[model samples]
Target: MTDQFDEDTGDYPLVMPGPLWKRFKQTLADFVLLLVNKCKSSYVFDQRLMDGVIQLLTGLADSQVRAFRHTSTFIAMKLSSALVDVAFGVGGSESKEYKT
Candidate 1:
């Protein structure tokens, strides 16, 4: 995810990830949310990681893989919720560029 970041725009490329990427993304999101839940303050300072997680959530939520509809939906909700907390953790300092 971070590899796809556009330095000029500070946004990820709008492209559908590969099939194998689905599991990798899901696992990473799960781990990220777990870490955020356990150590709320530890991740807020890593803006790049936060940016990737947000991008990951958006991608997974928008995916049309059709293999794990329920699971994807559930994880999306969890990630979205964790993101809200992360946003507050940073005092919502995320720049407009990152939001796109």
Candidate 2:
């Protein structure tokens, strides 16, 4: 069975079944995480680069947060945790004001 859809009619295809589908999604997530980590490391020596990276990430998270408001709370929690982790890591907790 075909898993792809025709682009003209706006039709959707059936999702890949079982293990293959799981593996595909897992692979995609891993690739994304790898890219993010690379970017994070590459900006360590440049404050301007890090600010740009932080702004981009914040903008992305804002859009996702708006979208997630209608979805499951579990996903929102996961998103919140990830953002907090990044922010805390970037902004040291040495100052009490920085502690969330």
Candidate 3:
């Protein structure tokens, strides 16, 4: 069996997404979301890592590619929830690492 899509799936040969599906484009948003979700604790108490996050997202916004812009925007939206969690310290007391 070939790696290509099977007729059972009914997915036609894709042409629209040829350029859109650049290397790691699909994983970019998910990776950022995972990072932001897991980093809430550090974000609440640290400035350096957060600064890097801000700078990275800002620089990604400077790209003219649709994939970069779209992924960055989606990551930014999801990141807001993480920021809110950090703002209210939602997981601090629940986190074992922060336990006294």
Candidate 4:
């Protein structure tokens, strides 16, 4: 499958549809890396970043048309918990918490 990245925002857009499993794996990996970097750096977590994460998770949750509701519910639960942990500074792993 081909990947599409937005030139202006450097955001990867799901231009082509693919298998649910593949999309889920890729999205999860991308999110994990982003979270790790964000936690390690002194970067301020802004609304845009949060929005993008939410959107990505939502897409992953709704990837399967047959079980959209169930997938979305599960994803929502995980996302909520993750957000809480991040807010409380307990989500990032020790190794990923500091970059320097």
Candidate 5:
């Protein structure tokens, strides 16, 4: 997702933060939140599915392991909390914490 012109210009070696990247990240975060919010009691209680979610995140984060560590942790926490709420039959009562 790099620009050839930018690279040829010899401006920087690191990936530059651009609008498209920002939008893509926002889209990704939204998708993750949607997936997490869809967790019902059945999915929450399904050990296999929970493990899959964890594995998926870990695998994806492996690309930028160091940078994604905290982000992945936060996503994991939210997913866990959502699962717990659904399991406890309290999923309808949205918490302020999850809004972020």
Candidate 6:
């Protein structure tokens, strides 16, 4: 008697699954697109916009624990700081204009 594994219909060793690296790269690229789109669409200091960006990055980080967790930490901190700077500058300028 011999064991048989069908390549076409049953479990097979030759079948190629999706590559993890490609998926990770795609997620990173999509994050860049989301960031660009968000920046281009608004000039207001809306909290929801910042929350959405953070959530998107966090979700990507969660999806690939080993490859992106550390990198995401750095990215999140830098982005948050940049957002704060922009918000402060805009608010300060707006208040000055009102005073003038």
Candidate 6: list runs displaced more than 4 Å. 1-52
For candidate 3, the TM-score is 0.50
Whole-model alpha-carbon lDDT for candidate 1: 0.59
Worst 10 residues of 2 by lDDT: 5-14
- In model 3, state the lDDT of residue 23: 35
> TM-score rank, highest first?
3, 5, 6, 1, 2, 4
Against the true structure, candidate 1 reaches a TM-score of: 0.39
Clashes of 6: 0
lDDT of 2 by residue, 2-93 (tens): 12422233221113457866676556455544544565546544678646655655554444333222222323344445445556767764
- The candidate that wins on TM-score is 3
Residue-wise C-alpha lDDT for candidate 4, range 1-100, written one tens digit per residue: 1124222332222333458666875585457545645663343266666677678667755553424434455556655655566655654465566754
Question: How would you order the candidates by lDDT, starting with the best?
Answer: 1, 3, 5, 6, 4, 2
Task: Give candidate 3's error at residue 46 in angstroms.
Answer: 1.2
Q: How many backbone collisions does model 4 have?
A: 0
Residue 27, model 5: Cα distance from true site in angstroms: 0.8
Pick out the ten consecutive residues of candidate 6 with the lowest summed lDDT.
1-10
Per-residue lDDT of 30-71 in model 3, one digit per residue for the tens?
A: 666577677655663588887787788777666655445555
Which wins on TM-score, candidate 3 or candidate 4?
3
lDDT of 6 by residue, 1-100 (tens): 0124222342221122467655654565556545644673373245787677678779756643433444566467656655666667678989999999
Ranked by lDDT, the better of candidates 1 and 6 is 1
Candidate 5 wrong stretches, greater than 4 Å: 1-16, 58-100
